[model samples]
Each structure stands twice: as structure tokens, then as C-alpha cells.
Target chain A: MQSGDSLPELAPGDLPRQFTSRAALQQHLQQLFPSASGALSPIVGGWAAAQERLAAVDPGAYGRSRNHLAGAVTHLSPYIRHGVLGLAAVRDAVLGRITRRPEGEKLVNELGWRDYWQRLWGQLGDGIWDDQEPLKTGHPASSYASELPADIAGGSTGLACMDAFAAELRATGWLHNHARMWLAAYVVHWRRVRWQAGARWFLQHLLDGDPASNNLSWQWVASSFSHKPYLFNRANLERFGAGHHCQGCPAARRCPFDASYEALEQRLFAVTPTPRRR
Target chain B: MTAAPMTATPMNSPILWIHGAALGPANPALVAWPGRPAVFVFDDALIAGSALSLKRLGFLYECLLELPVTIRRGDVASEVLAFAARHQADGVVTTAAVDPRFRQLGQAIAARVPLTVLPVEPFVAPEAGGPQPGDLGRFSRYWRRAEPLVWQRFKG
Candidate 1:
């Protein structure tokens, strides 16, 4: 990596094309984009690294275990999102490797989500920032706070799981799909923050922060684009997260997510009952 | 394995304007014109207004470093136009971007020079003589239309 720096390039005002180390790159970027803060993520960005990741993807395993925090999920979004790896190229790679439809179907379906979001963006333009439908969470949109609470933003929220997700997001610029769902639900439902606030916070740090995916997904959890507000219970979290967050969680005794779905629905939302058939 | 630098064949050939949406070697504009002098700009407003963090900027910078593009930062349209003038480009060629800001910049650049926007290869091309991304009100509805089409091109 340092080799490119030794060349003494000729283009005027062109920032150094190489760095002696990741630290050096970090230092240079700190000076260059002074407004932007935080340490560089361990995730390297380039086709070389991208190809290596692509090679390791196991579509079958991905389909089977993607919801687990330590699942065989492909870390392809940063690469795919930036166009370093085209969606078609990835699909071809998966198709070329799979012998049966089931092996690749979930992976392909996940790819479709990206395509769906982009297509939606083309149709909606900037309107992607707005909710696609009315909220189904049984609370008025006005009920949600307009900003993210400082505790959540600062990653000091007492719940070990949410704090860890917040910390990982800021430090790595990435999060697992389940963790993202959990965190979004916590923000919108648990904390009563507006989905837009969380969406903007995500875009500020996420490497693959395309507004379509980020905003729409946030809306999905907030029940503005889905049939119901997505929620997770402590049992579900412990089951999938393998007790990592709950092993010695400080809030373990009084975990807000500890309740049953029936209880949570009653406690968290204002359910408007449907009329009975006459 | 065989191609010539397009600069020799014509005067005012389009220079590629690489933006955030398409930062890789496989970008349609880069593929369409091999060896074309290319430029990438860090949009100042996005950096300042969005308050993008170092991770995002660093990642983008690293990606740009891997590609054979001249890198700069400032008003995207202005930087792209200046790069075009520097190369004596007749037009600007770029991959289409979903971001409206990109479209606005493309329009700005096109006001001074011809601009060409190439489409990205679709994840699932619409069925022949079928609805154009119709009924996107829900993913299930869209998937009902797209899932089978996507499987059609699967080689294995």
C-alpha cells in the first residue's frame, strides 16, 4: 500500500494516492475532511478486498443462518452499494456457483431488496425520505420525538445490546441485519424517537447509507411501510444473539424487552380495534 | 486485451465523471470508454451539510485510490466541468445515479458541455413488453413480478 506514495506523483493538488499505513491514511483524511470525525473502519474498500469477500460467500449457509448475529452473511453491501461490485455481477457469481434454486434463492432474494430499494428511489426521487404509507403502530406520527436522544447517539444507553449496536455502528460503519432491526425498533418504539432522526443518524455513519434502503427500512420498523411495527423480545434476542448481550447485562433484571409480544403490544402501542362483522 | 487510448482517436471525446454512486472499475462509463481520463469529486455540500464521518469519506477515498481516476473535492459540478476543460472534453459521460443531487449536477455540467448518462445493468430487467417497475407499493407485489424474471437469467 505504501508503494504508491513513493512514486512522487505529478498531478497538482491531487491528494496522495497512497498511504504508508492505515494510520497514515487516517491522519491524512482527518486533515482533508476535518468536519468528518472518527477512526477508519477495519473494513478495507477496494476490488481486491471485495473480490476476496465475494469468493467466501456461501449462499446456502447465508440463507440458513443470516439472522444470527454471527451468521454467514455476506459483507458485500459497502462494495455493492458503491458500485465496486455491480448487483448483476454478484448475481452471476451466485448463479454460477449454485447447483439448485434453494441454495441461492434467499441470497438472490436479499439482492432483490437492494434492487427494489433502488427502483423505488428512481420512482420516488427525493420522496424516499418520506413515509411510504400511514403508520400502523397505533400512535400518531407526532407522538415520536423529532431527534435522537443524546444517550442513544452517544452509545451510552444502559441497555447493553442497544449500546453495543450504537458503538459498533460508530466504530465500524456497519451493523448486522438483526442488530439493525433491534436498534431501529428500540429507537422508534422504545425511545419514541422519529424514524427520520434515526435514519439521518445512520446515513451520517453508514458506509452503505443509500437513503432508499436506510429510510425505507427505518419506516418499516416504525410501521410506516409495513403491516406492523417490528419488535424483538429479550427471549428472541437471547435466542438469536446467543446470550451475548444478556449474559451479564446491567439491565438484565429490568430489561424492557423482557415482556411477551402480547404484553408489549398492549403496553407500547395504542391498539385501535377493528369493527366486528355484523 | 487490445484497445487504444481514446484520446488519440478523437478530439473532445467525453471524459468520465465518477461520482459517489459509481466508484468502481466496472462503472458503465469507465467500461464504455477505456483509458478515458476520469475525475472523482467529494461533494462539498454533502460533506459539510450531511456531516459525513471519516469512515464514509475514508472508505470512498480508498475506493477512488484503486481506480485510475483523478481525485478532487469541492462543488461536484464545478470540479467535473473543470476536469472536462482540462481534458478539452466535448462531453461528460457518467453512470446514472439515483441521487437527485447527481442529476442536478449532471444538468449543470450539460449546460456547458454535452453529457451522456449510461444505465446500470439491472438486477432484474423488466419482463419483455411488461409493466415498468409497476406496483412498487409493496415489495411482495414487486417480487411477484420480478423474482421469476431474475431466476430466468440464472446460468446454473
Candidate 2:
């Protein structure tokens, strides 16, 4: 397993820059940073990898189907998060491909979201950790648990979709944006855990764990940064998820998410309907 | 005679300090000095505080490996300063970092050696000779100002 050359020994207090394989690299990192738990992600990170993903962007399809589980989404967040691929470069690539403005508008607008998060981070500094706005949900902040429960963390939530999302996060260090929103909503709204606890849990595992994006999005789901907590019913999940999690799942008999948004909102929020606009 | 714009010439053996924010070849500092001695320090505080998984760390290491930077982990300021002294460099050159922690480290390194913060290419640069983009309170407001600017670069 010659990666490039034989893996080099660590210099005095300096980390080794060479490895024979991804496994070797993972093992070396396991030894080097013991506090960092979990295995290597299937997603390789480098300029070449980022460019390869960039080359495959289908702007027309991406704009149309990006919200679905099996959508034509660009798996570029991890690389983009770390600045392995710059935002402008990605934008230019998208713009270069489209014949019509509408084709690339959605993808470019998504890039704008990334830029927006960074700008907020610059403005807020560490204040991104705090709630940007008070929760519109009737429940008080003290009602949420301060830590992520072990069942959720261990992927034993008895709900197939959430457990699978947790497994994917722990194993791969990445999740589709929909999965993140769904899993985060479950943690905060259904489980009554603090968004900060869930945010910290995500930061521990997400490859794209930029505090600006992760925390703010968590705050969005928690109704601290948005007008209302983002919610999804079983039909919404089953529709977009392509019936992946519900066919033979243990939770199928009595799924927690098995209700309409209206019903779920009434049950979870206990307040009047949350305002839809900012 | 017409006034000429100044070019950013390389300094006296300034060490190219690469941070997580600017690891790619497109980094302004890297663009200024392509192959000069460069170092990337994995800040200890950031790792332990976030409890960063090996997955992310490995990703970063692989990215740095693709570049010509020495990989080091410790107190970021100390390691960067040590790397600068090791090269007998007159200064440190880095692209600006958004994170406050890195800005503090840049200050420490600058206190010891001349440090230059180069401008990165923004996703949407401010209007030429106009007031800065305003009202970042929401994405819609910001995009109303930025979306037009972003598409102005498109030739298609």
C-alpha cells in the first residue's frame, strides 16, 4: 500500500504529512488526535476532489430536484466549507455552464447562503452561539434539555430515519442538507433538547462544521434564528425520501413524525401558528 | 506620465503562513508567493473545543498535503513564529481570516514579525467606489444588493 511514498515518521512535535492509504492515514490520525473520535469519512478531501465534484454540477437539474433525498445535489459542502474551493470560483463555474440565468440562479443563490453565513460570523463573532432572536415557540428555553440524549447520539432513537442519519453522520462526517434539517428538527422540537446541545453534537462530527452555518442553521430549526421551527411530517419525508425509511422500520407502527404539519405544529409548539415571514 | 498601480512584490524571504481559511492555490498570499516556505498549524484550541473528528482533520491534512506547506500542530502563534524564525524570514504573509481566534494569532505573529494580511477574492465584491453592502439582517435584504452584482460578471 504505497500511497505516494513510504509514510514518514513524525518529526519532533510535527505531524506526519505522508500516508500509505486512507486507512493508514486514519490510523495515524487516531493516534495523533485521540480526543477526536470516529472513523475516516468516505469523502476524500483535496483540491482535486473538490474540482472533480465541481465539474459534475448539473445546474438545471440541481435547481429543480435539490430538495429531494435522491436529488441532483452537489456534494461539495465539506470542500466548500474548508475553502478548498473558494465561493467565487464555485460561482464562476456555475455561471459559466448556464445558457439561461434561471438555470444557475438557485445554485448560485445557495452559494449566497454560504456567503451570508460567513458575513454574519464576521459581524457576530462568538455571538453566533447565542440565539439571534427569541424563540417564537411558546416553550421556554429552560424546558429543553441541555445535552443530546444518549439514544439519539448512539443511533438508537427507535426511529429508522433518524438512526440512519446519525449512523451516516458518525460514519461519514457529512449529511445531506435535508437530513440535517430533519435530524436537527427531531432533536430540538420532538426531543426537547437545546439547539446548542444538538449544535455541539453536529460540530463534533460534521466535516463541514463551520460554526456560522451549523449553529445558525440549528438556530433556524430551533426557531431562534427564524420565524418558526422548521418541521416535516411523515408524508413530507416519505415523499422526498422515496420511501426509504418507512417500509419495514420499527417506528412504522407509530412513527413520531406520522402527522400533518398542522397537527405537529399544534402538538409541538402549543402556541398559535408561527409567523411565516421574518 | 500616467500614474501606475503598484504591484505586490515579494518581501525579504517572508514565510507564507497558510491557515485553514486559505489552503488552496487561489489564496492571495499563495498567489503572491507561489513556492516560498509555507507552514500550516492546526490550532490546538479549535480542535479540543469543537471535539473535531478525525474525519475533518484528515480532510484538512489531505488538503495541506496537496500544497507545499509544513504541517504542525500546537499553539498556533508559537508554531508559526518558530517556523518564521527557522526560515530566518523577515515577515509572515497570510490571507485575512474571518475567525477571531486566527485574527488574534495573526496579531501575535505580526507583533513578532512583519505580517501582511492580503485580501481574498470576495464572492460578491462591493460596488466599485460605492458604499458597502448594507443591512445583513436577513438573506433576502443582502441578496437584493448582492444578486445583481454576482450576475454582472457573467458573460453568458
Candidate 3:
């Protein structure tokens, strides 16, 4: 379906009979956007290439390079998120390529995690969106008078990593899965912005912005998901983001915490002692 | 921001109610405790409350004279804790959905105070027919395909 077009009305029977494989789907997609051949061709071609890569590559490579922020990581999240690539199809492809190998076991576990998150979403239902800010009760984050919207969407954040990520999201409507975690953490913990704000920004921009993944991921970084909060330190920034690109990072001098990263992290993590249950 | 008026004496223990749905039989958990400072933890979908399910919830809330509660939207565990802390809530109540992450969070919160998990079945309006076998199959297929990448976890 073309972007911005209304979903075509379909009766239950009108839906496609059998699920189409990602490769077959990509071939059909190419026909829809033939004019932009060179620019789009590789994305279609990349699906095939990724399938091949999954066959021969080790799962360790995924863990290692997933955080590079540049394009080295597998860009499969968006495809999977949008249902452009089916999870079972991808799993089957990966499994077919590495059956009985140690890598296959590792990859299958990773797949299982996705299911786990989804199950969590189903289990929790709407409780997942409840507000959990400390000190401030019921004060929604100010969407107005905030640079967050422009910074995230317009790529004007000035932090090299943040800016690059924002730009990449806008340009390609995709971010590597690891980068998404980093960005969400930065926005919620380091930047001291509200998780809802970041969530809204992602929903507006990400092509694969599933409600479960985007909302849950933001909650995880905000320390809202777990009792202990997670903070991304300068050491982490330097390690994963070796490229040193953004010159305008608000946290440049202070690195991770001068930007209030630790406090933000602690805010989400520190759990007040609950009274003993009867 | 203006401070909320202190009408009644603060309860010795306050319950933080985290709701995942926008509407239905379970919504009373959110709207019932009026005047007691409770936090309403919800997600974009429920806040959007555009779905048929949630619309019913809004109507329910409107009909009830809710206790003093704070409405906040977020993912499950974090939102519940944040709401509890922000509101100085002594406990939490939520529906039983199978989010291990939220369950873990609930367990941790329970250690601190009371975390009550309410098992709620989706209340489809009577007029709405249940999903046919085919519809269930389509949804199942969609989930199976989306499961791997969407649900993959890191083994550290």
C-alpha cells in the first residue's frame, strides 16, 4: 500500500490467501516504485542479501555490530516491525541457513525474546502506558516550549549521534535496533526529557514504530520497566559511537551526566520501599 | 504547576492503579477510587482510546463519580512505579496480562507495598460478534511472522 493512501476496504475473504515471503513481497514492491530504481533497489536487494547473510553469518556478529549506529547492523527491525518482513519467514530463513549450528540456537533465542515482549504487551494490556514520573504527579511533559520535537524530527539536536540518528530516521524512516535503544535512552535518561515525548516523536517518524516495541523500549530505558534504572555513560557513548560526529551535543562538556543523565536514570530506577503486604 | 488541593487526609496507604485498557468491565479500577490520589498508567492506544473497546471505557468513566486520581500514560512497570512515587501511592492494582516484564515489576513493587493483579477478559460489546475462526487464523499468522524480530531478546 502507498504511504498516505487510505487502507482499501477488504472483506475477510478478500485478504491474500497465503502469506507472501519477504523476497516475493520485495519483488512486488519493486514494481510499485520502479521509477526510483537505484535508490530503492538496494533495499529490496538487501533483503535477499540479508537472507543470505543469515544463512552463513554467526549470531555473534549481530551482537557485536548492532550498536555501531552507522549502517553496519542488520536493518531488519523496520521490515519486521511493519510486517514487511514476516518474523516466521525471517526465522525460517535464519534457521534454514544455520540449522543444528550453535548460531541457530542463539538466533532462535533472540526471536523468542520478540515474542516475549509481545506477550508482555498482551498481558499488561493498557497498564504499560501509565505515568510513572517521580516528584511530579500527573504533570504531562510539556510538548509545547520543548526543543525535543524539532530536535528529533529536524535533526537539529546538535549531538552528533542524536542528530545523525534523527537525520537517519527522517531520511530512511529506519534506525538500527541498537541505535533505537541508544536514542531512547539518551532522550529519556540523558536528555531528561519525558518518555512520552520521545514515544510521540518515534511514532511520528518511525516506519516500523509498533506500539509494543516503541513504548516498551522507551519504558525500559526510562527505568520504568525495571526497578533499577539504566544509565548510558560517556564510556558507553565513546565505545558504541566511535565515529565522533555531532559537534553540538548538549552533553559535550559534561559528557553523559552533565547532561543530567544519571539523575534522569535514577529517577526512573529508584523504587520507594513498599509497605509490607498483609 | 498548581498543587492539588488537599481535601481529605491522605490515606495511610494509597493504591496506584495501572490500567492497560481504555474501557470495559476493568475500567472501574481506574475510575472508582475518586478523591484518592491514584495514578492511571495507560499507553498510547488507550490514551488514544480510539478503539471500540476503549470508547466504552470513556463512557463508563463519565458515568462514575471517580475518586481523586492522576491519569498518566506509559508502559506498564515504569509507569506504575513512577505514578506510585509521584503520587506517594502505597500500593498498585492492575489487570492480569502476561507481560513478564510487568509481572517482574509488579513483584518488585509488591515487595514495597501492595501490587494487586486483576485478571480481566476483554469485554467485546454485545453487538459485536466474536472473531470467526478465519479471523483468528489471520491474526495468528500475522503474529507468528512478526514474532521473531519484534520479540528477540539479548542474552547477556
List the candidate numbers ranked by TM-score, top first.
Answer: 1, 2, 3
Q: What lDDT tens digits, residue by residue, belong to model 1 across residues B1-156?
A: 001112223335889888887877789888899878888888889888888999999888888878878888888888898889888888888887777777778778877777878788878875673225576878888777788888887766
lDDT of 1 by residue, A1-278 (tens): 62222232447766677678889999999998887979899898877879999999999999999989999999999999898899989999999889999999999999989888887887888888887888877888899999999999898878999999999999999999888888998999888889999999999989989898899999888888877788888888888788899878889999999988877877788883221110
Q: In each prediction, how many residue pairs overlap at the backbone (N, C-alpha, C within less than 3 A)? A: 0, 0, 40
Task: Give each prediction's DockQ, rounded to 2 decimals.
Answer: 0.46, 0.44, 0.03
For candidate 3 chain A, which ten residues in a row score worst on lDDT?
A1-10
- Show where candidate 1 strays beyond 4 Å: A2-10, A272-278, B1-12, B129-131
lDDT of 1 at A20: 83
The DockQ value obtained for model 3 is 0.03
Model 1 residue B119 lDDT?
A: 80
What's model 2's overall lDDT?
0.83
- For model 3, what is the alpha-carbon lDDT of residue A259? 33
User: CA lDDT of A53 in candidate 1?
Assistant: 92
